[model samples]
Target chain A: MIRFDRASKRYPNGREALSGATFEIREGEMVFLTGRSGAGKSTVLKLIALLERPTRGLVMVNGCNTAALASRRIPAFRRQLGVVFQDHRLLTERSIFDNVALPLHAAHAPLKDIDKRVRAALDQVGLLDRAQALPLELSVGEQQRVGIARAVVVKPKLLIADEPTGNLDPALSMEVMGLFRRFNEVGVTVVIATHDIDLVKASGLREIIVADGKVQDPATEKLVVPSMEAER
Target chain B: MSGWLLRHVQSALFAAGRLARAPVSTAFTVLVIAIALTLPTALALGIHSVRSSTGEFANAVDVSVYFKRDVPIEKARQLAASLRQRSGIARVEFIAADEALKQFREQSGFGAALDVLEGNPLPHALDVRPKTDAADPAHMESLRRYIAAWPEVELVQIDSDWVKRLNAILDLLRRLVLGASALLGVGVLAVVGNTIRLEIYSRRAEIEVTKLVGGSNAFVRRPFLYTGLLYGVAGALLAALLAWTALQLLDAPVARLAQSYGSSFRLLAPGWRELGILLGVGALLGVLGAWLAAARHLARIEPRS
Candidate 1:
């Protein structure tokens, strides 16, 4: 679950990535953050991930205020959620199994449990046979699947992905989207940020459109600015 | 607890594997640390050997009490007996004027000149040796004053100045060794710290990925710490070996030099205690250097995307 009440983010370089962006997504919902490049979708996901706190206003994910969360608690907070990046972010020197086992290792899980779960996650991504292969040795889609397996290996309640299919063919992109859909079907809340409007339309998921540092209502095609006076 | 230990073992093995993969660089780093550590270790051992060998000479300080020419040999013997009775005096030997003259005649080659001059011109004397514990400068000075106050005593010479100078030199050398050890210890830390920093820089991608997947700073730093620890331990062990080998090579020469001086002093090998200290220090420096590098660099590498 996520709630952003007029959250604003201004980076150190003075670029206002997000300005007064307000949105809400309930538990067990799969939502697409549709926006152009540099349109602040990634900034929203960053706030949710606690990678950067909001410059102003409040951003809450899973009942924890991203702005108020202590820096020491950020790791534990992140462990409860999954994040997938467009680049896959796999350690190239490690095998696919080791890459997927990163999250479990971070958690200090039992070695037996880690082995079992890593295998299961790799199997889910249809890459069980490539467990011993390095990331560079795999195809781009297989690498992305390894990233996905790493994300879900810990069984996080919430999953957020940024441009998950940015480098994939349309067919590979559809397959990746289907993998996310399968996870959502099992009640995992998913938030994906992408400029793939076609995929959003085809997936028939709820879409929150962001442009020019503001979130716009897809229904009305107008900016959905929060009423500040009502909150006061 | 077992799981925690397993993680540590895993990190240690992983760190060792990384080092093994880069044999040339690791060996070079270890050599630098070993050389730095070896200087202080060898110096310390040298000081220990020197101190132990010179211990008897330092304690052999003797006071010579010469009696007046008119003093009778019986009276001088009685005085020597009384001096020996004192608690601080270990032994006292009374030499009659006749015996002193005979020894001087035989060794100084002045028997014909002395016989032409007078009969038994040398005075009676007592050689007084003090207990080792009471042989300090202050104690010896007091004993000299006490002996000089006697009515029949003409002179009381301590013969301890050379001993004082030798002790002072040894003390200075010990302090120098301590200072050198400290400075070189810092050098070791710097070498290890820089090495770890480079390793961290090269593994920047791995670090970012680990942190991106919810790894804590401690988790990300574990491997680097292990690497530093290995470097330190390996360097220390090699330093000990180097110091031992150096001692072995110098042993024959040193013994020959001592023999030339009519002494049989041999160089003492580094004892177990010294080896333990070297190893412990090496391990501590390694861990500390790694910790410093990780603390400075790991926190700055946040996942950007």
Candidate 2:
């Protein structure tokens, strides 16, 4: 589960990236953060990942206030969640298998477990046959799939992706969404940030739109300024 | 626990593989380290051999106390007996005027010329050998001054001047060796640090990706640390080989030179313990350089949200 209560983040340059943005999502739910570029959606995900902290208010994940989490514990906190980037972030020098096995390797998993789990995740992304191929040799779509496989390879309880399909065609994007849907069906919570309204509409998942450093309700698509009543 | 061990092993092997893949660059780096390390090692060995050779000469340090020609042989014998009991004098031999004449005739090969003299002109003398610890110039001088102040003594000659000069030269050589080793040590650290810096730069993207995937700073640094360690170890082995070869080349020439000098002194080779220390220092410097480079560069790289 994820919760952000009146959370705000300001950059060192005096630019407010997120201002009193608030939301909550229960376990095993798939949610989309639809926003324009630089709308602070990524910032929100970053706070949950403990890659960044809010300058004001509180952000909580799995009942732990991230603001209070010591810096030394950030790695363990991050291990419980998976993050995917728009660029796929695959190591071009390594094989797809090695790329997918990275998260497990970071966790110091056993070799046998790493191999089995990496294969299973690759299989889920339907790229099991290309495990030996290099990331540079794969198509853009296949590379993105490899990234997805890497993210879920750790079996993180929460999966947060920042514009994972920003570079894919609509068909490929839909396929990626379906893969995430499958992971969600298997009880993995998924939160994706994207500007793709068409994809969000087709997926029919819970959407929280963000614009101008504020979270807006999906039904009305209007800014829900943090109110004292909503602070509860 | 096994998994952790496996990861460390894997990281080390992976680091070695990465370096091995670039053989030419690795070889060049190792050569630089070896050369830097060998210079000081060779100098130190040179100083050690010289010190030991001079040490052998120091063992025979003696001060000759010649009695006045008017002094009686019985008085010289009494002085010798008294000097024998002194703490710093290892041995005292009394040489009467007649015995001194005999020795001069035999050693100078002037027996016919000496037999024509009316009376033995040689003075009664005492040859006093100093203890090993009192064989240096200052100790010998002090002993000479003490003997010259005696009533019957005509002259006191300390025969440790050459030893003192050799010791002074050896002291300078030792200091030079120490300074050169320290400078070369810093050079080794810089070589390793620069190599690691370049490695971090080339793999900047890999580092960023690793961090984003929940890899801790230590995890990200593991490979680079191993890379430095391998470089250091490889460099140390090569330096040992180089030093051995150098000693081998010098061994025959030095033996021949010592033969010409009528002394049998051989060049000293580094023992196993010294080699082990060289390897340990190399490895330690490698790790330190890698840690410094990684800690500085890794902090600058963060996964952009």
Candidate 3:
């Protein structure tokens, strides 16, 4: 679960990235964050990840106020969450297997268990055959899948993806979304930030539409689900 | 794999293997460190050699007590005889004024120059050697005062200046070695820092990804720190080799020099204690350099996500 209670973020140069914003993400929910550029979409995820603290109000992740935790403990806290970047930030120097095994290694997982789990996770994203292949040698879609395998390899309770399909074709995007749907079906909470309205419309998941640093709609007072079906 | 020590050592060795993948650069860096470490080690050996040699010279000490010309040779002989019997006295020789004059005339090449002198101008003297314990500068001064104040003694010439000068040189050498080692240690640190920095720069993206995956700063710095330790250990070994080789190169000539002075002294490498200190200090410096580099750079790099 994640909470941004009346949170706001302001850059030092006086740019208001997020202002007086709020939302709650419950357990095992698959939510889509649909917003335009500079609409605080990435900033929202960053707040939950403890990569950046909010300027005003509290940001809580899994019940702990992240702003108050010691900087050193942040890494352990982060290890509990799986994050997939839009750039498919796979370590290009290593094979797909090693890249996926990295999170387990950070946790100091046992060697045999790590090998088994990494193989199993790679199998989930359909990258098992490419396990020995380096990221540079993989196609873009395959590399993104490697990123997904790496993120979920640790069996994180929360998964955050920022534009997972930003560079994929329509077919690849749909496939990736289906893969995320499968993870969510297995009780892994997912929040994806994207500008892809068409993909959001097709996915039929709960959507939170943010614009100009604020969520729009009457549901904003309670929960702005961003679901047009609710309005109907 | 978790509790196995071989795993850690294997990882460390694997990390070192990565360094060896670029053999030329690794060799060059190790060579530079070795040379840096060797200079101070060689200086230490040299200082040790000088100290021991001059220590041997410290044994060549004596007291020259001059008697009044009117003192009878019999009186001077009695003084010498009893001085030799003193607890710490090694030997005491009596030289009557005539005997001194005869020896001077025999050795002075100007044999007739002393014949022009009247009444055996030189005074009868006693050359006294004390026990080694009483040969120190302070104790020698005390003995000189004690002997010169004797009724039969007119003057005492205990030439401690050469010994004092040698001691001063030894002290200066010690200070010089310390100063040089300190300076070179800084150089070693700088070398390690720069090496770690370059490694960090090359692996910057890897570090970013690691941090993003929730790797601690300690995790990211582990390999680089190992690399520095490796450098230090390798450099220390190389320095030991260089020091031994230098001693070997100087051994024959040094032995000849010793023989010229009626000695059997030989050039020797550092003893075990000094070797241990060298190895330990080198590794410590390596660790320190890596720590400094890691503290400065790892804090600045953040996860891009």
Candidate 4:
């Protein structure tokens, strides 16, 4: 569950990454944030993840105001949701299992529970056999899956990803998209930001188009329509 | 509680593993800390040994009251007896002129020369030892004046100036030791802090990732704190070992030197209390340094993407 009320972000270098961008996503929905490069999709995700606060207006994720949340409380707030980056963000020196078990460790989960959950998350991503392999030793897709496994290891209710399929082949990209679809099928709300219009069209998910640091009006925007409108 | 302890143990082991992976750098860092600690610890122990060896000399201050050569041995004995009744005088022993000459002849190896001389030239004297509490310079001076005013006394000499000078030198050395310990303690802190800073810098990527994945500042800092603590603890242990070895190497030579002085003084090894302090200080400084470095740098490394 995420809601943005005219959220604006201006970086320290005076770059306005987002301006009055407002949107809402209901629970249990998988949505794609479609935007060109530097079109503010990542900014939206950053705001949602509390990596950067909004310069103006309001952004809420899982009932906590991202702009007003205390910095000390940010870690606990982040544990309620998962974030996957385009670069995988895995510790290269550690094994795939260690990388995936990070979130559980961060949460101070029991060692036994951490081992079991890590294995389970890796199994879901089809990388159970590569548990002990380092991130650099794995294929790029497998590395990204390991990142996904890490993100989901804590069983966060909302999962947000930024350009996760950016470096993958179209086939691999679709496969990664299918993994997201599987998680969504089990009632995990997912938000993915991407510029892959083809992938967005093929996935047939609800699309939020952002341009020029603003969210486009869905009614008149020239993009893929929401196919699950009747359910909404 | 067990889970909490397990996490701490895990962090400690992880920190140790990281240091082990970079053995050369870690060893160099620890050596610097040990050297810094060793100087102060050795100096402190040396001061302790010096103080203990000179304990008797520090407490005793004696004066000699020599009577005029014309004074009779009977008058000298009466004067010594009266001096013993004084408030500040601890003991008084009358030495007859003949006895003094005999002692001088035996100790100075002047027997053949003295055999050719006429009658004994030494005067009767009283060896006066003052009470420990009245051995201060002013008190000794006043006591000497009191004895010099005696009609039959020719000289009243307080043989305590050298003792006072020795105590002054010891006091100066004690201050120097205190100053050096404080400065070297700061040096230890700086060494550990800088090492931890570099460690944090090298692991910046891991820190960012951990923080990104819901890791608290405390969680991210746990390993670095443990790393600092290990460095401090290991350094202290090595310093103790080094100090022990140095004492062993110097013990025989020191004993021989003391023997030359007709003293049985031996160098004292560091005791359990000193060892405990070294370890405790090392661990405390290590934790403090790591905490400082982490507090300064960790919060600035937010995940950008």
Each model's interface RMSD (Å)?
0.8, 1.3, 1.1, 0.7
- List the TM-score for candidate 2's chain B: 0.80
lDDT of 1 by residue, B246-287 (tens): 999999999999998778889999989999999999999999
The C-alpha local distance difference test score for the whole of candidate 2 amounts to: 0.87
DockQ of every predicted complex: 0.69, 0.57, 0.59, 0.81
Q: Model 4: per-residue lDDT, tens digit, B139-225?
A: 989999999999999998877778778888988999999999899989988899999888888888998899889999999999999
RMSD of each: 4.6, 5.2, 4.1, 3.7
Indicate the fraction of true inter-chain contacts that candidate 3 also forms. Answer: 0.54
Task: State candidate 1's TM-score.
Answer: 0.90
Candidate 4: deviation at residue B65, Å?
Answer: 2.6
Residue A58 lDDT in candidate 1: 93
Worst 10 residues of 4 chain A by lDDT: A223-232
Q: Write the per-residue lDDT of candidate 2 for residues A48-154, one digit (tens) a residue.
A: 88888999998989888999998667767778888888999999999999999988877777788988999999999999999999999999999999999999999
What DockQ would you assign to candidate 2? 0.57
Sequence-dependent TM-score of model 4: 0.91
Which portions of model 4 show Cα errors greater than 4 Å?
Answer: A217-232, B85-89, B96-121, B131-146
Candidate 3 docks at the CAPRI level of medium
Q: Say which candidate scores most in DockQ.
A: 4
* Residue range with the least summed lDDT across 10 consecutive positions in model 3 chain A: A223-232
- Candidate 3 clashes between residue pairs 3 or more apart in a chain or in different chains: none
Model 3 iRMSD vs. native: 1.1
**Docking model 4 quality class:** high
> Could you estimate the TM-score for every candidate?
0.90, 0.85, 0.86, 0.91
Better of 3 and 4 by lDDT: 4
